[model samples]
Target: MAAQAEPSLLVDYAPVMLWQAGPDRARSFFNQPWLDFTGRPLEAELGFGWMEGMHPEDRARCEQVCQQGFASRAPFTLDFRLRRNDGEWRWLLETARPLCQDGQFTGFLGSCVDITDMRQAMEERRRALAERELLLAELHHRVKNNAQATTSFLGLQASRATSPEVAAALRGAATRVMLATLVQDRMFRIAENATIDLGAELLATAQAAVDVVGRPGIVIEAEMEPGLLLPVSQATPLALIVNELVVNAARHAFADRPAGTIRLALRRPAPGLGELMVADDGVGLPEAQRRNTPQGCLGLHLVPRLARQAHASLRLDVDGGTKATLRFACG
Candidate 1:
């Protein structure tokens, strides 16, 4: 048995500021909340008096929007700065709809909510995001320079080495340095996307396998699931394994062939396990040396160590062509 509230009472005490305009496109009424917010009498706020509180910079655009809506008898929404009772400028999001009486257009009704806090919060987030991107760019540049310098020094040492074995070892070390740098670059490019899943950085390295190996006749076929994520701590070692396998295939698989294909793939075959495989269709490994490391190929000798570092088991196959698989915990 609560008394029913009157329509005028409800409108006057509504949470949002409300207003009305007549068929003549002049402001006809403003509720008590609107008067309280602007510290103006109802008489003073009627017929464009409310416009006096709008920010000068937004006046023309806001007026134009209202005028357009009035002309078409349509609903309209706008955001603009309006002066508060204490003279502080505050953002307001206002929406209006045409009012009809007995199928005839009579006026418009509008409501507004203060949005100053939301506007300021959004601006702060934008500034923070811009600063983060700037820092990441600088980091990527510095990392690239340092890694390139190291690789250059290693190459120089390999060129100056006296023994064939020493030179090959130095060259292999330089190749490792280069591949590690490439993995870091790919990691940097994997954005914590606002749209899709995060961190499948291995996909970038897999797609560019042939280019990274610098083998003229090698074409890499990269197949990767879009959302396969890897642990950052193990990413570089996993990348090195793939890099070494591709390098071996490019060098030994194609002896006299002008073109060959290297199929590189990374997939989560089980709930908590991942697989990275590299296979090439060229010369198969000799049966006698298939079980052991290929003779004189210093790079393949280190694949087992790299696999251990990644906490992965290495599997070698010599069917039709050489296939290398690394199984790891990458859930």
Candidate 2:
């Protein structure tokens, strides 16, 4: 059999070492670099002597894999902790291939590379990502609480207003602010690992709207398909649109009715499209406001613009009663 020196191989590789057993079961040849790295003389590192430097927990597995390679004449690779000269446990990736002569296994050659830095870096990154998510959740919670306080203040001011028009305007403003706060709260509440589920979001928005307008005479009903999830970007606009439509229905549609129902439904309109419809069995929209009113209400203007941003469409069904339909891109 022809023998090759460790440093003479052509391929670029990390530092390597070689050991061959003699007839007396002692190392016959030990590489120069291995002696320098271990800071030990050839006598102390031969056979099973190297186990003294490996982490005690890893020594058994390392020895077992090395033995398998020696007996089977196959390549082997393993990752383990090894104690450095300074008594620190460093991670290492070790690989080896068996040596043979005349089709009989003789010894093995191997290489070791330090992976301590890489492992530490990965751990640090994981901790930083976890911290960032915690901070974001706390910030969203505080912002939602502040918004609720502002809505309460607005409601108090509306109650004290002398003019009916001023009270109505203040109430409208408070409703809009509440809608924005509810959207933020929903986004933060159901997010799993920083992603919002669109289906759950829509369902939550429907529930929140009903809660806000808790009128005893007006019955709120919602029908939605399961397993639809929207990312935060798409969910925000859809929630606000639903909020405006539902609030409008509760305020104006059933203003004079004894028994009324407001239905809010979400369904798939087409591929990559999510559709919502809000209809009430009360007074219909005025023809002038639906067709020719130059300066539309803020809610009307905002809902249509939001639908457009979603690459969706909006329409008001004024034939029988007030029904607002919205179609938007979910993809």
Candidate 3:
């Protein structure tokens, strides 16, 4: 038996194989000259002695699998860490096949190969994606700020124009620009992606409209329910409609008044419906100009157009001052 085992060492295959007689009775043997690498006799280097070369975290698991393989007469495949010749712990892919005979339980044979680099690369990719999303959010904030500055400049130009035709046209352009700006401005403040708080945007719009006049005596009162909050989809037309109605009141409704009061209110009148009213305590619409004059008829006609755009019905009451009420779908 010694002569046969010695000759097997020269076969150019692994000369040592690990085996177990029972659960805790594992052993390793090498043919002929191969035994010198261990620097110990076969008996001392078997069973629990192998723990010195196996990582502490891996030893218990490896012993468990070996015991299970012997009891079940099945193959064992697992992954674990091992101490290498360089004193470093390396990850290994371990596999063991049972060597049963005639349906009786037998030990398992196993080998291992190294996958640490692959796991580290996947972790790096995850971090890179997180950083990219952070950069995109910052870019959106900067772009919003720049757009608001441009809209403010346009408002200033409209305020300075001397011609009525030029001024009215400029005001219209400025109002549209501001409506667009308010969508993003309120969205940023509220931290929503595309929706805005209608109540907040409405207040801001009224304030922005008042800022155009630069007069102190103008008292603008807004009675709004918290329900004024709407998404940008609904806020856009509502804001523009409010803008036009207020502009008309400031420019024409208070033409001969000593004291002026403009009242604005927004509320939900019924399910799925919203109501808005703008009224001023300036001079009421002159009966002749309200119906006949083209120059004075622009605001009245345009208010309906804007209301129609938002699917709203416009009603005008000229009893004391111009009161334009609009009711429409919440969408």
Candidate 4:
């Protein structure tokens, strides 16, 4: 008969480390490449002896996974650290599938590849992401502090101004700046996904604007739809628009009354559209001002500009006090 080649020769020269484990979940065979990589003799690596080269922390888990996979006769993959010939621990990715002959499960055929470099790169990338998040949070904190300082300085300047018009202008500027700061603070505090809760943001901004005005008799109530979320880009402009309208209501709407109520409502009135209504039960706007003209107070001028920026329609109703309606497409 012709000389017969050894069955092991087929896989001994393969690039990956090939192995086989018997049905008992103990290693039965280690190819030449595997044995050479571990620098161990066949007698020393057969059966469960190969586990000695696995990291101590990973050995138990690896054995448990292998046992489960063997019991189920299914393919499985795992990663672990193994000692190489040079005594250095290297990461390895091992994948194994059930072996069967004549429809009877016999053992597990497995292959392992050195993945130390890939694991190191992934770890570095994770560290870089963590560092970036930390830096962004710190930057937001500094911005908030600077905004607060600037608001305080503006308040001081407003207090010292001799003319009422100049003082009012300074106060308005300070309030606008504070509104921007509130938006930034809220953005930084939210998750990295960058979705803003419209109701919460509007409530906070309205409350802050009310507090700044310090009107004891005037009550500002917000009736917003729950869980209205918008991206940062939309939220910022929408917040500024609401801030202007709310402040306008507090200042001009209830001038003659000792006590009044300002109701701010935000709702999704239609699909892909949002509406905001600022209504007050105080003095209504004058006929000329109600016409949405650019020739009016700072709030009137600002409302139109902000509405334009947000792609919203601005309408003023003077029938029952002053109601400002802003409808915009949300899509």
In candidate 2, how many Å is residue 314 off?
3.2
Q: Which of candidates 2 and 4 is the stronger one according to lDDT?
A: 4
> Number of clashing pairs, model 1?
0
Per-residue lDDT for 181-218 in model 4, tens only?
87667766766657777888877887777777777788
> Candidate 3 residues 8-58, lDDT tens each?
444325533333444334645333322243345556656557556667777
Select the stronger candidate by TM-score from 2 and 4: 4
**lDDT for every model?**
0.80, 0.72, 0.64, 0.84
Give Cα distance to truth, residue 88, candidate 4, Å.
8.2
What TM-scores do the predictions have?
0.73, 0.67, 0.47, 0.70
Which structure among the candidates has the greatest lDDT? 4
Residues 1-331 of candidate 1: C-alpha lDDT, one tens digit per residue: 9999999999998999999999887899899999999998998889988889999999999989989999999999999999999999999999999999999999999999999999999999999989999998998899899889988998899999999978977776777678778777766665545222222455455545556556776787877666766555576677767777777787678876878888877778898887888888989776765753555455577788888888988888988788988888865
For residues 1-331, write the lDDT of model 2, one tens digit per residue. Answer: 8876565342223265455553333455556555656677778788767667778788779778766666666788998886666677878887766666798666665667778899999999989978988998788878878888989989999999999999988888888899778786766665443445555666677667767767667777778766566666667787787787777777777778756888878788778777788788878776666842214577766777777666667888776677888776665
lDDT of 3: 0.64
* Residue 185 CA displacement from its true place in model 4, Å: 1.6
The best-first sequence of candidates by TM-score reads 1, 4, 2, 3
Could you tell which candidate, 1 or 3, scores higher by TM-score? Answer: 1
Displacement of the residue 104 alpha carbon in candidate 3, Å: 34
- Candidate 4 segments exceeding 4 Å error: 1-20, 29-46, 49-57, 60-77, 82-124, 284-295, 299-321, 326-331
Say what the RMSD of model 1 is.
5.5
